[model samples]
Target chain A: MKTVLSIGVVLGAFYLLWMAAVPVMNIKWEVSQAQRAGVEVWLPESGIRAAGNWQLLSENLHLAAGTYAQEKPRLPSPVQVFAELWETTVEKKITSKRSLIFHAQVTLSATLLGFAMGTALGVVLAVGIVHLRVLDASVMPWAIASQTIPILAIAPMIIVVMNSVGITGLVPKAIISAYLSFFPVVVGMVKGLRSPDAMQMDLLRTYSASAGQVFWKLRLPAALPFLFPSLKVGIAAALVGAIVGELPTGAVAGLGARLLAGSYYGQTIQIWSALFGAAIVAACLVGLIGFAQTVVLRRMGMAR
Target chain B: MRANLNASKSASWAKDLNMIQPVIEANRLNLTFQTNDGPVHALKDVDLEIEKGDFVSFIGPSGCGKTTFLRVMADLEKPTSGTITVNGVSPEEARKSRAYGYVFQAAGLYPWRTIGGNIRLPLEIMGLSKSEQAERVARVLDLVELSGFEKKFPWQLSGGMQQRASIARALAFDADILLMDEPFGALDEIVRDRLNEQLLDLWARTGKTIGFVTHSIPEAVYLSTKIVVMSPRPGRITDIIESPLPKDRPLDIRDTPEFIAVAHRVREGLRAGHGDEV
Candidate 1:
């Protein structure tokens, strides 16, 4: 217990140091933008955006919350913005039915569906290219080329095309997610399937195992290490793709929609909060995938 | 030496060892491989017969078609002009029925599978029941002296241990014949000697017919009841030496005059097969 406590204190000190640096860093980037916008010198000569009360970490404390800091150059304190985080997430429910949690649930549903569809398609294509000689010859070149085409430019086109064809709402965004997510999986799985040496393949042939048996017994299991890292990348890409799809078409309810409103109305705090929210969401999803990787491999007795 | 097989053709091949009745008969076997430059004849008019429970080794120089012969028996490559029979059935028919096990120069183990799982692979493919597969795996693992390494990955083990695991895998399904191509070729000399002794012990205990291909003459002489010597660049069998050394061999047998004599004979046979003066 004492050892744990000591380590925790060290980590606490590091976090405090980090938070102390963050307000300045955030303001510096913002000030550069403000300067580019040709704003007059809004803050004091000291580059410190916080006035006098410069508490680094605690949400309850900051430069703006102090008395002497009132007349100095001002910026939103960590206290005020963090308080807004709690209010927007917990207290400010939409008719007590919808909040950040509800919005997260909605977005997660679409993201997961997209991830599943993307992974399945990727696996099928990889298997086709691996097993069918014609597909390997004809399809692989196009698959490589598809990844090079910018998905950001491609996402809007997909959304518009789907809208025209009478398929709209969640599907357009899901299609975009699949488009971005599958390439990594296909590439990873292909490398993995080919990873077995010639001797290993000969061993399978010696037993007269069918093609499917060779895949299930050898290739598929061997692909696991490559598959997991790619899934993490693919899931993150899926989230980014869903967000990009929202940008052009103007969807409501997702964090993307929240960003558009914030940017349009000059709600910098709200926009920042939404950006943080999206980061946290993506982190959680990737973390969940990592957790599953550990559990599944451990259960299969593949991992030590 | 089987100059006896060089039948005065026409009517004699039919009378030689009852012709079509041997367990494994390769008559006028030829395997041609087409490379970019031209067609290369890997095996030329090679003929041999292996009866039940015979331990045979094909030994020759580096470019000799010994390994090619083993590959042919496994039906991994089709012969250009010849017929091979495994128990009266064609090589392809026997392979489709999973009639034999093959061990390669490398262990060829899947790194993802543990030792036990690797051994269970052939059994799984043969569609044996779960309990049966596990039992057979345990039995063969014990046979190979790897009973405790069931859960260890191939990469975690030493090369010798991995090779032993592979040997266990081939034996786990109780296949009647084993086609091993330089199975201990990668091991250190000490390990190779140990595995050779163990392999002979295995052959004695199980009574499984073995067809091994090796470039080592002493190894072929030490383990085989019969050593077949071949030459390549026109791959054909030039000598078939029936070992007069007693079947129960030990490491100390190498120091004996008889073992040295057999080794001398194998070397001469290899040289003669390669068209070099012996």
Candidate 2:
């Protein structure tokens, strides 16, 4: 209850500040316009626009109200953004490409697919690195190095190469998501797989347990606590990758395409709504992983 | 030595005669660990023999090779140079045959598993029938007086009870030899004393060849039939005292004059090992 109240208070304060800033910035723009026309302007109140004369107070109020309702303000007020969100999401039909929900669904499918592939690749790589000294020496460095290249710089190339090979649609986007997500899982799993202390290892050795038995019975269970947190981070990164992926595909039908189309025509409210939509999707994905983590760790008695 | 070697190699007919052979024999055992600092001798020229059904305790200060020697018997560590035999075979061979169960200093129970599940781990790994595993788990839990608490997780139990569950886990596999490394070292003295009494009672009932490691003089003298005292800085056995106590002893036996005398001798041996450094 307290957390919800705190979040509400924060959002309320942010909206109030945004509402006040929009009107004040409009008056400041008016003052700048008057000064450019060689008409002296000054304000009695102390603020950034103190040089503006107070004679245009009624005109400034009308201009401020206009700024709040503008079709393309430099920064849309919170009410405008939310209204746009409601129209695009709740007001549109589910099947309509104009609906943010429809775009969100497209991005979500790619996110889930990429997250699954990334998790599998990460775990497999971690297991290989743990068991084989050769992989640890050779593959681990390359895995680390793979993350240093900018994904934006490489995303277009990946799409182009895949286009050349006629592998269009979702696969190339997922590969980028997997590329971003796998590194964290690999690093986390390696540490987790090695978390068992020397004494525990010695206990298993006394049983003369086979390597496969040791892995299944000990390392795998031990690594689970490490795997879930990495998965949460990976899912969020996958969402970001899916969105960025939509950009290079020439503004098709996802949230990334919405962002691209909004920016092309200076649709500020559209851009803000799309941004909030993407954020909501990322939050939902991360929250779902958190729910899974709690349930699993509780079942394992690893958490209270 | 030759007779013992032959007894190990000979067929089952030789075993029908009930041959006298050491269950664990170590001759000139040495282990040196190479660290960043230098080579530190963990065990040096350590020769020992443990007969069947004997309760042998290794006692010393920290860095003494008591735990090292037990680990060697478990094949958790290999001696730099030595000839040791467990159950008339190489340590590795005995280990592969699952010839012994080891209890660590900590309870080390898997928190995810209930007490019953933890005890079933070894039996499961050994590929026992489900009924057999259940039976053995029940039996050992009974042995440790933890029969009714099988469904409890390790964290739900007290420290002493958790350690007892670990002991039950070891006994579930029915190995003839048990190696314990200060299994009660973490508990308070009152709990430790009760556990010691319980352990002696269990040992008498089972008659398993047991090797125990400890740092306490009274603990070593109270529980062991043979106490090997060791010292640090090259870690060698300074003295081996054969206890004159009877086979069965109560908790009050520690108050006896003979128990005090044995403890005093152990303290002396430890002091001698330190060689005026203390």
Candidate 3:
């Protein structure tokens, strides 16, 4: 109930802001239309006739309706965006090219595949960093520096290079997601692998346990708590990476394509709906990771 | 002062019978840690011998290197000079052979594992059969009086119980020697006393050579057959006291005249070491 109320409050504030902007947008649109049409208007000042004032008010009302329902609005109204979302999602068949579900499926696949690859790379790098001094000194700084490069700046280059190498479609997008997701896993895993105190390490040493045995039995389990949270972050990063990967490719099958198409056609409502669709997909993915974290940690007896 | 109980007979038996061997031997063992502040002498010229089935306790204040000495025997720390042997072999070889079980200051039970699972950790590493692992886990859990609590996670148990579970883990492999570093230091007096009594009984039953490190005088006196008193700052042995108290001592035996006498000697030795500091 509280969440609902909070959401309602946010929506209420957005509606009020939209209502305020409507008149301003209307007047601006009218001025631009007049300028484009080269229309000159003369206004009578200090009018005492009630009929004239009523006529002005009616014209303003007509202008507000036209602003709110513009075919190519600069800022789409909430109701218009919602209607577009419903029409794209529920009105179309799941397999239809026009369906948001079909587009979401394309993005989700890339996100999941990239997330898996990224998680694997991160955990391996983390283990290496923790166990091997050379990697710890050399690779960790590079892994950190990789994240500083914005994904948008590199995504197109990556797509183009991969295309030259005969790699196209899903693989390039997944590569981008993996690139974004792997860093957190490496950072989290390294910390988790080293979480054991000196005494605990000594205890294992006393047992003469092999390094492999130590990793599997002690370090690995200790790293689980740290790994799950990183995975959540990685999955979210993977989603952003996947969408960004879609943007520069001129791809026509994913949510990114839908956004590009909306922008090209000045379909503000379509763009807003596509943005909302991506957000919802990311939330679901993160929620799934959180659920898995609870289950896995509980099985390990780390959680109640 | 050494009591030298039947030393002539034991010496003769060791020579003639060739059945008795020292479980641990340290000869002029020195370990200096190189730090940013310069070399810190953690252990200095430490010479000691622990015979088979001997319950020897190293008593000293903080930074006395008692724990370091135990770690050296466990091969967890390397000596800078001289040599130490466990089970008549180098510490490293002995460690590889799994000749001794070590209980650290903390319980060191993995929070992710249940008590039973924790105990089975060593057995699993040793590549024991699953059945054997389960059997040994049961036996050690029984020895530690934590039999019914096998399924409980370490966090679910009390502090004393967690320590007991750790002891069970150490005992799961049935090693001939046990090295404990202040395993009961964090417990209350009552729990410490109870654990002391239980440990003594466990020692008697297994006849394992035990090296215990502690700061408490009574704890050293009560649990050990031989007590080595140590001083800090270039940690070295100041005195070795052989307890006259019988092996079959009860908790109330702490109040007996012989127990009190031994405790008094331990206190005097500690004071002597402190006097040397001044």
lDDT of 1 by residue, A44-145 (tens): 456435533232223222321232122122233444445556777888775432255555555666677788888998889988988899989988788889
Q: Give the TM-score of candidate 1.
A: 0.81
CAPRI quality band, candidate 2: medium
Better of 1 and 2 by TM-score: 2
Candidate number with greatest TM-score: 2
Interface RMSD of each: 2.1, 0.9, 0.8
Query: Across residues B1-278, which tens digit of lDDT does each residue of candidate 3 receive?
Result: 14476787677776653245678889999999999999888899999988888999999888888989999999998999998988888999999999989998889899999999999999999999999999999999999999899999999999999999999999999899999999999999999989999999999999988999999999999998999998888888989998898999899988999999999998888888788658
- The residue ranges of model 3 lying beyond 4 angstroms of the native Cα positions read A1-27, A30-68, B1-19
The worst-scoring run of ten residues by lDDT in candidate 3 chain A lies at A42-51
- Deviation in Å, model 3, residue B216 alpha carbon: 1.1
* lDDT by residue for model 2 (A89-141), tens: 99999799899999999888888888889999999999999999999999888
Give the Cα lDDT of each candidate: 0.79, 0.88, 0.88
DockQ of each model vs. true complex: 0.44, 0.73, 0.72
Q: Which candidate do you rate higher for lDDT, 1 or 3?
A: 3
Candidate 3 or 1, higher DockQ: 3
Q: List the residue pairs that clash in candidate 3.
A: none
